[model samples]
Target chain A: EDKVVQSPLSLVVHEGDTVTLNCSYEVTNFRSLLWYKQEKKAPTFLFMLTSSGIEKKSGRLSSILDKKELSSILNITATQTGDSAIYLCAVEVLFGFGNEKLTFGTGTRLTIIP
Target chain B: EPEVTQTPSHQVTQMGQEVILRCVPISNHLYFYWYRQILGQKVEFLVSFYNNEISEKSEIFDDQFSVERPDGSNFTLKIRSTKLEDSAMYFCASSEAGGLAGMETQYFGPGTRLLVL
Candidate 1:
């Protein structure tokens, strides 16, 4: 079975602190890794990492994938209360004949204190 | 920015009852999907549809579950008999391109919370 594991299931930090969320996966025919932020309802797309070493960044948020280690890390710098949410990491894998599915991690719950 | 939309944000049904969950994927998207998330659990893929046919489905998408693109726009999932284990938030998503070469970002709906008693 394909599995994606996330570390530090829950975290609480004061504003302006930096935090790193980790995700590791074990799967076959890897296609890509995606990150999402879930606030109250649906999850919003954050980043997609397909290659190893190269980091994808958006403003204060950045992510890097390490294929050699079978893991990825999402880093948030100078976090604010608005950054509080569940961060989800999903690994996309090809099953057969062009079919693909995303296996997701349990997600890391981040709470930013003011 | 266009977004996927789903109806009946919440539904409560008794065991053995049939229910249909509706979704309207982004108009320009070609690939559609259905996923579910149990409370405090990971989001799980149920099925993926393309060209008006089922391209792929997961083990969790059993015989009781069916998907249809009734019209040119509306996509629906029908559960023949609801079970307590079926209680979860059903999310609808769509992507602009096929999954062959990656670069497809799935935009998800807010999701419908289903409770089977």
Candidate 2:
């Protein structure tokens, strides 16, 4: 079975602090790894990583994938209360017949304290 | 920006009742999918539709579940008979393509919260 595990299931950080969320996966025919932020309802896209050692960033948020280690990390710098949300990590795998499915992790619940 | 949209943000139905969840995927997109997330659980893929047919489906998608793209814009999932365990947040998503080498960015909808009593 394809599995994606995220570390530090829950975390609490103060405003202005930096935090790193971890995700590790064991999947066959791996195609891509994606990150999402879930606030109250649906999850919003964050970053998608395909190549190893390449970092994808947006403003204060950045993510990098390490294929050699079968792991990925999402870093948030200068965090604010608005950053509080459940961070989800999903791995996409090819299942033949030109089809793909996303296997997601349990997600990391991040709480930013003011 | 074009995003997927689902109807009946919340649906409450009795067990053994039938319900149809509707969705309108992003214009110009060719691929559509259905996913569900039970409370306090990970999101799970249910089915993937392309070219007006079902291209793939998970084991969770049984005979009781059916999907159809009846027209140019509307996609629907029909549950013949609901069960208590079927209560969940059903999400509709779409992408421009379906293969492994494509962009494969599946845009998701806000989801319909189904509660079976």
Candidate 3:
């Protein structure tokens, strides 16, 4: 079965600390890996990684994909209280000719302490 | 910035009743999808649509569910008969294209919370 697994289901860190969340997947027709941040509402797009070894960054957030390992990692630096949320990692799988659906991990809950 | 939009942020229905959830995807998007999350659970994919047809669907999307792009802008999901277990946060998402080479980002809307009694 196509599956996504995220480690350290929950974590608590003090403000300004750097955190790394992991996601591993095994799926057929692997397309791309994506990361999302979920607060009280729906998850918001963070980064999409396709090629391996190339890092995608947005301010304090960055992510990289390792196709050989079938995994990806999201790194958050200098975390703030506002950064506390559920970080979701998903893999896009193409089941048919041109259709894609994302299989998501259980999500890593990051709680930043003041 | 363009974003997907959903209506009736919250809905309540009795068991066995039908419910229709609506969404307006980004104007230029060619791929649309529906996903649901039961409280404290992972987001589960229900279906994906492209070229006005269902391209793929998950086992969770049984005969009880259907989707329609009734107009130029609206995409809807209908539940023939709601069950108490159907209560969840249904999210609507849209992407400009689908597949590995497209590099499309699926943007999600504020989900509609459905409560089945």
Candidate number of the best DockQ = 3
Q: Could you tell me how far off, in angstroms, the CA of residue B15 lies in candidate 3 after the best superposition?
A: 0.5
> Which pairs of residues collide in candidate 1?
none
lDDT of 3 at B57: 90
Give the lDDT of residue B7 in candidate 3: 89
How many steric clashes does model 3 contain? 0
TM-score of each: 0.97, 0.97, 0.98
Query: Can you write out model 1's per-residue Cα lDDT over A1-114, one digit (the tens) per residue?
Result: 899999999999999999999999999999899999999888899999999999999999999999999999999999999999999999988766656778889999999999
| Stretch of 10 with least lDDT, candidate 1 chain A | A93-102
Q: Judged by lDDT, which candidate is best?
A: 3
Best prediction by TM-score: 3
Best-first order by lDDT: 3, 1, 2
Query: Across the candidates, what are chain A's individual TM-scores?
Result: 0.98, 0.98, 0.98
Predictions' DockQ, in order: 0.73, 0.73, 0.78
How far off is model 1, as Cα RMSD? Answer: 1.0
Candidate 1 has a TM-score of 0.97
